[model samples]
Target chain A: MNFILHISKLDKYFDNLHALNDVNFDAKDGRILGLIGQNGAGKSTTFHSILDFIKYNGEITWNGNPINEKTFDEIGYLPEERSLMEKATVQQQIVYFAKLKNRKANWTKPRIKNWMKKFDVKGDLNSKLKSLSKGNQQKIQLICTLIHEPKLIILDEPFSGLDPVNADLLKQSILEAKANGATIIFSSHNMNNVEEICDDLVMLRNGEVVLNGSVQAVRNQFGKNELYVTTPMPKEELRQLPGVETVFVRDNEKYKLKLSNPDAGVELFKLISKGEYIEEFSQQPPSLDEIFREKVGETNE
Target chain B: MVKLMNKFKAIVQETYVNQVKSKSFIILCLLPIIAIALIVIVGLISYQNAASSGNDDTNQIALIADSGIKKSIVQKDGDSIDSSIKTEQQAKHKLKNDDIYGYVKVTKNNDKYTAKYIGNESIDGGVRDDLMQNLSLHQNKLNLSNNNLTSEQIKKLSNKPSFYNYVKSRSNDNKSDDNDIKMGSLQLLIYILYFFLFFYSSITATVISKEKGSKLVEVIFSSTTATKYFIGKITGIVLMMLTQFAIYLIMLFSSYAFLSQADFAKSFIKENSNYVHQIVSNLFNINLLFIIFGLLLGIILSATAGSLVSRREDANKAGQPVFMIVIILFVLSIMFQNNSNSIIPKILSYFPLSSYFFMPIRMINNQANIYEGLISLFILIIFIIGLTYFISKVYKGLMLQNNNEGWFKNLIRGVKYR
Candidate 1:
């Protein structure tokens, strides 16, 4: 099924503060959409609106229909603040949450072992959640979210407190869920993770959708202004090149340059290469991190 | 609707199982039984001690009086007097030897009787009173005989009258007996209601606040609506309460059955069989409906209070208002329990908050009719329904609110969101 979650001009006000203003986005099936924002940027508010957990001034529809109780059964949400029943065993917690999502305990029970192995969770089924390390507990929470096989998965800050290995495990699981034709939408501060996994991206700033598109398209819109070159070119020489705005030394022989325009990249590449062998010469759009800071920094300025 | 109900059932099952399996629940369930067993054991031991002490010969006293006076006074088999010590000299000798507890002397002078009790220490108040009554009775018999009255005439003059009470409001022939049973049942029901309300309200509040504090409500709300979630939670706790009550009832009946096999319990049951039947009947009447509704109100209100806060530490503080209301109503109910016919209690009998306390008391006192009880119950039911609906509406907003704002501010914010 080609499931799609559509939000249309959603607006939310908390007392005198406009928490979300005319926010609009769509998350399609079999794809990962990353919602990114600085602190207090209404990313959670947008998720809340989609989940129908709060009162807002717009409509959120799932597959061209209003989200309802049955839709909720097909939807799984992992909240920003990770919390599970500390007193419950891993199996009990997973089964309980699965049951809430309309899955039978027997069905969830057998799958727990596989998920434990997949996530490398170092606890047995009967181990209490509190007995596990923080990373292992988060893995258990992730298992709870995906065990029901929800078609629409909403995860808020799923990778906030994970080591690189654990984060890679979660990333693999998210991609697996996506491959199974689930609509996965997650919010994160890790721009690298977002850039790596997100097929689509929505950036919110001060309760407004500042940027929205596929990850490649959003990054490409900023042009290939960033250039990394490892050559004999000194920093002073790189700064003197036309169309090069700034020169940054990354290593003993490497230099990174920011172009004032996309056309500047071609000129810069030609100058750095010079029909000779260069160890590294690459020009690409600015990283999502830079774009995020620039967009969020625009407001601060 | 089926899916909604399924989710509701899931929530209820989770809550019920989680709580029923908790150490606190197990401890609470066993606490009363342990306390009851302790009380019974202590009571039996005390009774045995008293019974054994009653037969001590040294604890006995001697009564020395003229033969005419002694013959006129009637004595029971267990009277503390030793008939063997017939003279003052022997009585004094026994007292000095610590063989007797005391000695009493009786004499008549100028048609008046006087008694003197002598011992190393004062006699028991009960023994002294018994001796004084015996001397006064002998004096009365002598006075009547001296007034030219025959013995039969004196006996006729001393006959006591029979007394009975008749209440105009009660339709039963055994009004006083029924009233006694109802009064006793009313107190028991009130105590149960008070205890269950306080206990279950706190449980409901803690359950909600814990979820809120742990930030697990969003995941829960995603699976079900707030109304269904609230109803499911309250229903789950109510079912747990019923299960606990059932356990207690089973324990009570089992204990009764075991005790009934004993000779003392069997005789006691036989003596108070009518009272027991009446009390059981009264417990299952309309008053029970009031208690159920009253408990539901308390639990629902406490749940609302619980939702008003975003942290577990604030849960007890949030519940304080509901607890205060319950405390006030309980106090008022007790104060007006005997004054059911008074205007204040009559007025309170119809109010939902106080009616649970006053209506049952008035009905037992025959100051309120069955119709009034039903009306009060109806009002309570309506109030509970309305409050439940209102709280359910604001529950989502309350659960979503994460501000450190105080409860009242959060409540206002939640209401606005609703």
Candidate 2:
């Protein structure tokens, strides 16, 4: 797939402190690119630079031409800070945002209405934004960002403060954007959603890209032959098996084992049979959360 | 340019509509009416008390003296004089019965004259002073009559070379009095105007800046040029102010119409009836026009400054200098009018802030001609608009800039920093 955006040797600094150092990245149309990092690891800084939040050295080109700010007329940005004018009404605010994206009011209003309805936000067009709950306000902001049908959307922790149902609702909306031929840049601390949606991703540490690629490929690239078993057995009994490097008990019913080779699973099967009949055995890929901890050594896990 | 202008018009229309519909805008408009009504009600009560205080203006005072003495002390606008009275007891009884406010009991005591006066608690200061002066004059006349002074001599004594002053210069006696009143009124008007402007613009500026502080500006900038958005935002706010002003004007007009028939109604204006006709001739004065224009300029310029900051708190801080400058100019304008034709007022009349308050007053009294006021007004307006444009440019640049930059440092960098 042809890359929609390419950034190379991109650098930024704040006085004596180097903020973004020689970052290299790529993204394609119709894809969701996840960005993961610690609180201070420059994920926000990168998104900001793309949106011209800061002036930086080096180049970030869109479709081979340098990304000019004027091109933002076709882009939507949802900042993680979660901001909106409380004084304005829901429809007035939505229309204003849509206007910024070059949409006419007559055309924009109905679309915002449809989005609000789809999200199950029941309210009149005249309801003040301040009266809405935190979750509902967030939904309004999301609707604002998504109103313009932008080609490129940057959502910085858009899932924050959302309940699981709302989060799922937002995820589906994002998938809908992808289906509509839009490129989405998603930055977050939550790995599960990143695993769920991101076709490719990068983990940054100390303003430098540490790991990058498709989540599955990257996990396998940093492979440790690991097996997670769910069996009705005690952890002490599983720990005594040969070829099992160690057994980490999740609870009474399930256990995770690190293996030296693919054949090490046979030893787990024998242990399972001796103690309690094995409920199930399957070689599952390491969760993205686990892989991130091992690579970045982040303590979030 | 036309495209941009059209966009600006659209923004302005939206702003005006929204602002007029806003609760705050409605309140701002209603405040002036409420204030006027309250003032009128309070004024009516005070005027009633004052009008009834001295309703008995016909009470007579007696002077026990000669027939010619009555002729010398006869008041032109008062009741027929009481020619003579016997004693002080009669005077006290007359005062108590409201037959007389007071009376002077004159008695010849050797060479020098001695007099005793009786009055009630309700006696006025002007009447008492007049009575005392008349008694002294009567004593002088009696002394002259005893010396067998001729009528020609008395006439000569009365004419003490009264000076009738005249001047062809811009400064003249009558003009000077007019200048003081004009200056004071002009200064107060400009101050009120500036206060209203600041109140309106600062709130809008705060709202705009909050968008940046809250990251709303950044999100909007993602889909449009910051310059366009900033221009649109300011345009919207100004339109709102205009709407508020229009509503306020309508309310004032209606209130005036309603009050003009009342007994205590002092017209719809805080000015003399002749002011409307008199102000016409002064309208052409360049200096006067300049001063008014300058004041308007100050409002616009200060508003532009107010909008340049990225936070509501920052706008308050940034707006202080502009506000102080407006107030200073307003004072200077008043000074210019009060000290008409003086070196200080003359010089300040050409100054940006000082001129708006001074010109109208000077022009009305014919202290300064129409052309001078108008020319000054035009220049001041241009200066203020230019300054506002520059400030707007700075605001546009900083709207998308890293808000972490401190206000003073960012200002020093001049809207662009690598």
**Strongest candidate by lDDT:** 1
lDDT of 1 by residue, B1-418 (tens): 7756778898899889988988878988998789768856865776678779877777878878887655544255235778878999999899888889788788779988888888877877886776677778777878887899877986798888978876664345776777688678878877877787888888888888888888888888888888888999999988888888789878878876766676435555566767876777776789877777788888888888888888767766767767888888778777777777899988888888778888888887777789989999999888888888888888898888877787778888888875
Per-residue lDDT of candidate 2, residues A1-301 (tens digit): 3538777888988767788899999878899999998787898889978876668987887778766555776688998889877678999888877766667789888787789887878576888988888788889999988888888889998887889999999999999999998888989889999999999998887788988898888777755567777876677767777776777887778778877676777666766666565666776567888777776775444
Of the true interface contacts, the fraction found in model 1 is: 0.76
For candidate 2, write residues B132-223 as lDDT tens digits. Answer: 67667777877787788789988876786779887754333466555555554555455555576467545655555566667776776676
Choose the strongest candidate by DockQ.
Answer: 1
Residue A153 in model 2: shift from native, Å?
1.8
Q: Please give the distance, in angstroms, between residue B256's alpha carbon in candidate 1 and its true position after superposition.
A: 3.3
Spell out the clash pairs found in candidate 1: none
Q: Candidate 2, B310: how far from true, in Å?
A: 6.2
Compute the interface RMSD for candidate 1.
Answer: 1.1
Residue B11 displacement in candidate 2 (angstroms): 5.1
List the DockQ of the predictions in order. 0.75, 0.39
Off by over 4 Å in 1: A265-270, A273-275, B63-83, B104-190, B263-282
Q: What is the interface RMSD of each candidate, in Å?
A: 1.1, 3.2
| Decoy 1 TM-score against native | 0.88
Cα lDDT tens digits, model 1, A121-210, are 998999988999988999998998888999999999998999999999999999999999999999998899999999999999999999
